[model samples]
Target: MSEQGSSDTYEENERVLVHHQGKIYEAKVLKVEHTDTNNKRKRNTLYLIHYQGWKDKYDEWIDSSKMLKLNEKNKELQRKPLSSLKKKPNNNINQQHQQQQQQQQQHHSEESDDGRPTPTPSPSTAGTSTTTTTSTTSTSSTKRKRVDASVQESQRLDLSLPETLRKTLIDDWVFITNDKSLVALPRNPTVSDILDTFQQQHQHLEHVKQFADGIESYFNKALGVMLLYKFERPQFGEMVKLHPNKPMSEIYGAEHLLRLFVKLPDLLTLTELEDKTSVVLSKATEELIKYVEKNASTFFLKEYAPVTTYYSRLAN
Candidate 1:
């Protein structure tokens, strides 16, 4: 950003809207980092903001480009969701799956990247798992726009789930959809926490380092729209009420994240991404799944919160 623009706009305590991942949140500036006095003319302005109505932990420093001045026009922008293209997707999220049914026409899940550097991506599309309460790669200032799903024949993209996780998916499906249950909130080892744990222990893994943001972005994006089952929607609404501006990565656990993989191939195919890209994302996903399996007792919950009658009423 021009020093001129930085000088003219926003100051401490000023309220604004921030475009993060595929959504926008209302924020108030706590501090402004502009070192123009050191002759830094071309540096963009960074705002350390507290997302209004959210906890301080979610506060972050974002560059000017990601922010919008608070006004009626921008408020309208904040109210509507940005498409995958407008928000940007990480191809490192390149996990693939099958569109087994023609009726499974869910929009390909979009993802939220950390605020970081861009990894060179091969031409592909992927929906990766992301967690929020801990560490995900910082979103890069430079991002590749996601490929919009086109009007073409859909194809198959698959990931082989380990038998353990396969069973977990079945049980999860039964619990949430059939038994009227919900994964309790403020989930232990949230999606963000799980990813952080994966990064901490597996620093040696190349893909983990390369596509951290992509994995995070895709998971957050998918959870907001594509990942939740119908019965869980009210619980999701409850989460939104509690953490109004926070991402799902902060609220959900491995069980919900694992479900993304089972459906990612479908999310990926929705994009015009090549079949080859699926292989790359699928492999990276396998590694993450293995880690979760190793710590299943720790990362996943054996018991779920029963859906309350009031929450069920919201569904009717």
Candidate 2:
């Protein structure tokens, strides 16, 4: 049995409760032994327990883990004054006293000529009535408080988005348009395809190659674009098939993406994409920020515009 409080060690003859076949029995520890098994180096302790009211044949050795030390009732018994312990009657003594009282009650009933035994209230029963009432009232109040606390905890919110939208946002690549509208790109797009799309759109800008090179370097160093496509395509396809006309932002907005990027290191670790050099990784991250800023417009949703601005400032 496991020791209850300050000590892990238990001594023989200690009173305890042993768990046996889903029932708890009051028992005394007869012997405590530590043995080293042949197959394992660690030593294990076993307790031989003799259950109260059980025959010696039923006594057996048990693991320490299956034992629990004396509970409140036993503790209270142990703490009683010696005078009280001396006055307390054993089970056999109580039974004999009860039989004598019953015999007297039967004799009194016979003298009354009713033959039926009249119920006589015992002094102990009368004394315990008030205690039982007070105990019940206190128990009910405690239960009410626990219920209220549980209800309050259940109602508490963590301020996170719904699970589906959160999963969709983090698992797929999101795109921003010049009009400040958000889009979730199909996961099948290769790194080369993404580069082509950006180059075609910003062909007149001289610095576009820097952004492209940054993206290419990051993909080659950290996680392959092909790997992302493989991991994300099926879920993306299902979402698109369900809502073909809905903008990706409507399905999972920029706020979700903002939260996703906030835990970028955790995401990278979870996806096993952490091999990139710090310089290349940082450059790629900056390129993504710049891409969003270049495309973002004043017409963007109020909730999303601030995220773009924050990343834009970081990039600069």
Candidate 3:
């Protein structure tokens, strides 16, 4: 379980689960809440999650204790063994071969029917016309083609954020002051809102605004959205302040751990996916993304794109 606060629940995009709706699912928590109604306050804490399928349509809520923290070890344990059912063998010969044999037999009968043939050397003919029977046996075995190497490698990967982000979100942060434990943040951060809070700390909203713009412009909208998800808006500045010299991938490694999908353009069945997907993407970077956008919430080892360590980290 993640080291979340007793009072604070975890979100969906940051957690992972399996056996959801009768299928194994690997997902991150998007939201977490407790359902408690007071006379004036209505608190329904439901954790919105982003899993393999459903993208963001379905969410599950339980008491804080029921929410399990997603980890690499847990993911490996969820894998089920593949069924060994084999396909029936097919040994039928081609129809063309049968037709050719019939044609040769007909030609031989016609040749034997020719009236000009009159060679009859009694006992010598019997010896020369001796029949010979020969038998030939042929064996052919079919082997299933192996899965692709790139696909196999991708399947082996655990698509989640880095350990540092995981520890920060679920564990107690190293506190320089008493009564200070940093909570794990949302996968996406609202940059403007975060910059607003930083305005007070920086003593100038414009300076912070400029900095926020830099972050926003650092990557395209898709990656920017990923950044928001990896870090809570409030926690963004802290990560940058702590690792100013690091790349954005390292700074946003936690969101990467969730293994978010990017739509690769002009790949797979594009029309079918576009018609079904709820999340929209731009014309650019369409080729750079992966997975066909669909509502189905299952992640088959064969379906996900090529997984690489470079894409796995936020620092790069």
Candidate 1 weakest ten by summed lDDT: 94-103
Candidate 1: stretches off by over 4 Å: 1-157, 270-280
Residue 236 deviation, candidate 2, in Å?
Answer: 53
Model 3 lDDT tens row, 23-109: 235556655544333222434444545544442223332233223345654343234221111121231221222233344345234
What would the TM-score be for candidate 2 when compared with the true structure?
0.22
Ranking by TM-score: 1, 2, 3
What C-alpha lDDT values do all the predictions have? Answer: 0.59, 0.42, 0.31
What RMSD does model 2 have? 29.8
Q: Indicate whether candidate 2 or candidate 3 has the larger TM-score.
A: 2
Better of 1 and 3 by lDDT: 1
Cα-lDDT of candidate 3: 0.31
Error of 1 at 173 (Å): 1.6
| Cα lDDT, model 3, residue 280 | 23
**What are the per-model C-alpha RMSD values against the true structure?**
23.0, 29.8, 28.9
Count of residue pairs whose backbone atoms collide, per candidate: 19, 2, 38
Q: List the residue pairs that clash in candidate 2.
A: 1-64, 1-67
Alpha-carbon lDDT of model 2? 0.42
Which regions of candidate 2 deviate over 4 angstroms? 1-7, 39-41, 73-316
